[model samples]
Every structure is written in C-alpha cells, then in structure tokens.
Target: MKVLNKGLKFAPTKKIDKFGVFVDLQKFKRSLCLKKYFLKDPVTRQVLGENDGWRHTELKKKSHFYPKHLISKEITTFETMVLDEMEKIQPMRSQNLTKEEKEALKELAEDTTITIKPADKGGGIVILNREDYDEESLRILNDRDVYQRIPYNPTEEIKKKFDKYIQKGENNEFLNEKETDYLTVKYPKIPVFYHLPKVHKNLNKPPGRPIVSGIDSISSKVAEYLDHLLQPIVRKIPSYLKDTGDIIRSLNTITWEENFLLVTCDVRSLYTNIPHNRGCEAIKTMLLEDGEIKKEQIDYIVEGIALIL
Candidate 1:
C-alpha cells in the first residue's frame, strides 16, 4: 500500500494493472522463484527462506540480474551485477587454492593421473601423477584450472567415475526435464516447443544473447492460450517495425480490456498439471493481502491465493 500510494501520488492518471498479482508456490518450489529473482533482480526484502549460496557462486559472472538495494547502491545496474559476480568468483571459484594452488595444479596435471575419490562428486578431483605430467591430461586439467585428489585403487576410482557419470546424468540429462528447468529456454519441458534456437548461444550476437520473445511462461495449455491472446499484439504492430521487434511492442493491447499493474509478478510451482486461473489467482492474492499475511501468519508459499475476490 505504501508503494502503491507513492506510485499513485507520482502519477495520478497512471492506471493500476494489478489484475495479475500474487504467487502460489510449493515449499520446494520457492527456491526456483528465488533463483529467478536472484538472477534477474537479486533484490528482495521480503524473502529469506532458501539460500542456495552455492548456486549463486557457481553462476558465471554474466548479465543475469540487475543489482539493487545495498548492492545496487554500491554498484548500480545489471552490468554492475554481472561484473561484481564475476570479480567475486575469480579468487575462490576454481579450486580452494591460494598462490600455492596453481603450482600444485601444474604438478598434478603432468602425471599420468590415476583417479581417486576423497568423496564422490564428478568435478575437479585429480590425483597428482608420480610420473612426468601427462601434457594431454594436463591440458584438460589446466583448462579447468582446478583439481583435487586422494589416491584410491581402481575400485574406488571406478566407483567414483560410475557414480559421477550417473550424477552427471542426474544433473544434466536423463528423462527428468526439470534438471535445468531454471533456465527458461529451448526446451521448457512444458510439452510445448519453441521454433527458435538456444540462448547465451552467442554472446557476440548483435547486442548479446537474444531475449526469449515469449510470455513470462506458463504451462503448455496456458502457453497455447497465451499465444492466441498475443495474436492481436503480433498483427497490430507496424510491419516495418516487425523486423526489429526491439522497437515494437509485442503485446500492445489486452484482450480483457484490463489495465495490468506495471508491477511484475512471479509465481512458483506452476507446472503443466496446475490450472492457469489458479496460478493467476495465487499471484493476485499475494500482492493484495501483503500485511494480512503477517497478521494471520499464513504459509508464505500459498500466500498468493489469500484474496477476497
């Protein structure tokens, strides 16, 4: 209300588009939304449930989020966010090594390299060779610039490799689609498919990675409905501007004659199995009854659905 009151005072004539507000998230699913916000906006005063600091540290310093709040006060804008993330990563990123770490890496990489497992995880576990460094192996190791090892017989190494192989499958591939579901891209795994190519595809492309030209995203059915809603936005844009969509508004008009809030919303746990309207209502409730949530101590995950209308 404070923010809304301030917004209205600033622009009395500005219409409020609060129709699509709120969020419905399962507890496990909150991380997904938080991951998105941390990557995109990375500024939240209200949320502090799941803190996946490792994931943030793992993310390469790229233009994923726009830094704000204190981080932004010190370093404003998204470009700053990208750079700061990158700079912080340089020291601790590769391996838990100091100046001595690189030298150890060099010494280890040269060996024929028997494998070992201090613990089973597929990355950066290398055993220094007793023989002259294998330049071939060294190249791969040096390229990554990180390795750790503890001597184990073939039994352990073989087990480690097999487990890692399976883990890699768990991390990237296999039948599970939600593995990389964090990235809103080529395969949404929503049973719908995009006709375009992948993104971060070429950092050099025009301005950089092309923005995924689509809705914030929803289920396959919701997506199909959205596509139908967007038909008018697509056809009404000036043809000349169509080629350069950067200048044209994709969804220029609304079907419901509803003025949408300038506010951007995020919902969680919205899978193909979920109903579209249910998801929408959840978002609405979340925004409308912000303080009441505190009063009632409602579960924040489903807080978005707490609305009168």
Candidate 2:
C-alpha cells in the first residue's frame, strides 16, 4: 500500500510553526467505519492511551513519534545488519587472495574506494574516500560533456539584501540571529563543504554519487520564509518525470520512431551548481510576467531569494 501527501493542504499548528508540520486527519479517519485508531510503538511494544497519540506528539514529525532512544536502537540494528552482510559477502581477507582471485576481483571492482569509521556521537558510520576521488570529481565538474557549470556569488548579494531589509525595517521578523550574524559579522563570506556521497557495493563493483550541500550561511528561519514566499507560485509550473512510475507512463505514450536519435542527459551537481543569480532572476521574471504579484512583493521575494541561493 502507498500513502501519499500529493494533495494535502498545509495547515500548521500554533505550537510548532516554523517549518509547518503536515496536517494529520484523525477527524477524517474517525469517519471511516473499519478502524479503531491507536498509537503503537512497534520497537518498544508499547501502546499508548487515547489522548496520548497524535495529540501529544505531532504525527507528521517522525522524530517526535520515534525519539532518540528508539532511533539509536534502530541505528544499532541497521549497523549490525550492514556489518553482517559485509562479512558474509567478503569473508576472505585481501592478503589471502590467489593471483586469479585477485585478477577476478580487479575486473569486478570500480575505480573508486571507500573507508567506513564509527561516528563520534551516533552509532552510525562515517563513510569517505581518499583524495584520489577528488581528481575524478573535479574532472566531472569541469567536463562540458557531463555538465555546463554555472557559477554565482551569494555571500555579497545576501549581505547587501539583508542590510537593505534591516535599514528599511521590512521583513525584520523573518531575519533570525544567525542570518543577522552572517550579514553583519561574516560579510561576503559563505562556507561550503560537500557531504560524503553514499556508496552501495555490488559484490566488488561500487559506484558513488557526486557530493553536494546547500548554502549554510543563513538561518533556517530565512530559508523557511523564502520557501513560503516561492512555493505556491513555483507549484504552478509543469513538473518533469519524478519517478519510475512517471517514466513508465511516459514511455507507454511515446511513439518510437525508427531513425530518430535518443539522447539522455544528467545535470551534474544540479541543485548546488545552479547559477545563483540566474535562478533568482528567473523567479522574479516569472512572477513579474504573471502580473498577479505586486512589484514591491516581487522585489522582496527576489531580495529574499538572493540569500536562498
């Protein structure tokens, strides 16, 4: 069975209002005749009272439902599974391998390596590779055949916009302490670091994804404000094929021609590498073209989105 939030409306409660929690419809579920509603923690085998279910803990927030204690237990279980699977698949030591076995392994191995270490706080593993991966990654980033890289500066632009907003006393509530610090103390400086890409080993061959992380200069409040401003307008645009189901459906509708060429393209570091100025400009252009939003509002949005980039 598939549960989807495809058509759900955003209605946040007063308690937790920053990034609005998803609206859980227990009232609607009460209308259904077949079920007796209750909250149960499967891991702990604990059943809660009627008033203690969704009301006490926001149902949409998974962390609220499954707290640190439960998450730690689950992480340990998953870690054990990973270690067990690795042992089962790769029982023989690399030194014990015969010449032919080593040759076979070489044929199966990809041009990548990963080392796993236990995380300091959580019972999780930190997986990363040596500097050898950097050369290959850089090549991919610069390769025109793979991706046309576009660059933009957000640090200066964001600070300028924030300063303007502060001077004007507009959207002052949206600017949090961190964003203020970034604008004032950390002017024209944005720190960026790539998260380690996950690697799923297929016997010996392993392929890794390119690493990317979002802008971390501003506060979550500022990000949420921008999201709220842009989301409704952005939602009007036609969406691309999102998943396997969409792809299959699209394929079914296609008329396969005999002589036509089929070309596939994957944008490298798509989100992170998008030209920041171009994106903000595009959003402003679209909103202006729509003519529904006022010029002042569009200006505010564009200014807010500079930080978002």
Judged by TM-score, which candidate is best?
2
- Model 2 has an lDDT value of 0.47
Candidate 1 similarity to native, TM-score = 0.15
Model 1 Cα lDDT, one tens digit per residue, 148-197: 34455334333343334324433533212232232223233322211111
Tens-digit lDDT string for candidate 2 (235-304): 6666655577977897888899999786778795687676788888888898888775567656766776
TM-score of 2: 0.38
> Residue 33 of candidate 1: its Cα lDDT?
42
After superposing candidate 1, which stretches have Cα over 4 Å from the reference?
A: 1-105, 120-309
How accurate locally, in lDDT, is each candidate?
Answer: 0.32, 0.47
Q: Judged by lDDT against the true structure, how good is candidate 1?
A: 0.32
Error of 2 at 88 (Å): 36
The numbered model that scores best in lDDT is 2
Structural similarity to truth (TM-score) of each candidate: 0.15, 0.38
